[model samples]
Target chain A: SQTIHQWPATLVQPVGSPLSLECTVEGTSNPNLYWYRQAAGRGLQLLFYSVGIGQISSEVPQNLSASRPQDRQFILSSKKLLLSDSGFYLCAWSTTLNYGYTFGSGTRLTVV
Target chain B: AQTVTQSQPEMSVQEAETVTLSCTYDTSENNYYLFWYKQPPSRQMILVIRQEAYKQQNATENRFSVNFQKAAKSFSLKISDSQLGDTAMYFCAFLGDSNYQLIWGAGTKLIIKP
Candidate 1:
């Protein structure tokens, strides 16, 4: 079975600080990876998605960015965090087909 | 562009009761997929059910089922024998053949009261 691992389940960052949230999937190769953010008690918004390594398509252009450094590793990063950047970030992966996605546990970010 | 609409922002039902959450979508494509996902306080997304646009039969999983009306562009989820654990946020999502991204609805917060 495939499993997704996300680190720093909860993060507290000061404003203008750098941000890095990592996600990795085991037991799958060449999967489509995606980053989604959910505001407090709100719906999810797609931020970025990647079809393959070094290929990322951004949905909402903001301070956040995603990278697929390896086939199973995906990272969401920001050079400087903003107060608006605080939210719950999720990582998901799917196959080449339009099958549904398998999501990670998510990272809750609070920029104070 | 495809869009999903979940008009219900909140719903409440007594334990062991039944509840239906409504969802509707707009898409120009004939072949696509619709899904209902649950997010509990744990914040983990759990897939409840899915419906394929090409299929005529509605999809069901255990106590969960979907009333899919392709022509009407409606896909409602029915949860029977609801439990307190069912309290969570339910989101309706859509995926068309043209894109891999899932268009999401605003979600309906469902509460199962004891």
Candidate 2:
């Protein structure tokens, strides 16, 4: 039984401001964590993924960056937010490559 | 590189009817996994069905089933006796052993009318 928690449920940030979205998994050890962004009417876009602590693989180059400081903790951050950065950010976890992912309730970011 | 495609952007079906959502993928890997995920208005994504490339039998879960054509690189999902609760965004994804990233398709919005 594993659960992923992502917050804050919704966020409103000013342009050029910093951003930090946190995701943590409970009830699983050494799980693979991922960060995805879904723009309106678009599919999920992979931003970053981590197989273990202190290991991060970025899928695309963007204004965002990810860090896995702990086994169950994955963080997505940005030093300067852009207007295009506004979207629904999701966090997901999976035990293996063959299985499906369990996603957390996404964070709606509105960069005005 | 692996890519998934869901052509239908939106579809509607009456309650109690059957609906099939089409999905096609392109991949060079012989061994991989395909999955269908459902995201309700609440935005909680859940796995509807999965098919392993090595298996010939199509995978089915309750009222949900998959038509896996490995050679054709097509994997479609069939929802039987659709309910209003079935209204959601359905996504197709592909995963291979070479990459941990799951390649996703542009989702199809399925609306089950009452």
Candidate that scores best on DockQ: 2
Residue A23 lDDT in candidate 2:
100
Query: What is candidate 1's DockQ?
Result: 0.74
lDDT string, candidate 1, B69-102, tens digits? 9999999999999999999999999999878899
Per-candidate TM-score against the hidden true structure: 0.98, 0.97
Off by over 4 Å in 1: none
Candidate 2 structure, TM-score to reference: 0.97
Judging by lDDT against the true structure, name the best candidate. Answer: 2
Expressed as tens digits, the lDDT of each residue in B1-113 for candidate 2 is: 67899999999999999999999999999999999999998787888888899999999999999999998999999999999999999999999867788999999999998
> Model 2, range A12-98, lDDT digits (tens) per residue?
999999999999999999999999999987899999999999999998999999999999999999999999999999999999768
Q: Candidate 1 DockQ category?
A: medium
Model 2, DockQ value?
Answer: 0.82
Per-chain TM-score of chain A in candidate 2 equals 0.98
What DockQ does every candidate get?
A: 0.74, 0.82
Report the Cα lDDT for candidate 2: 0.94
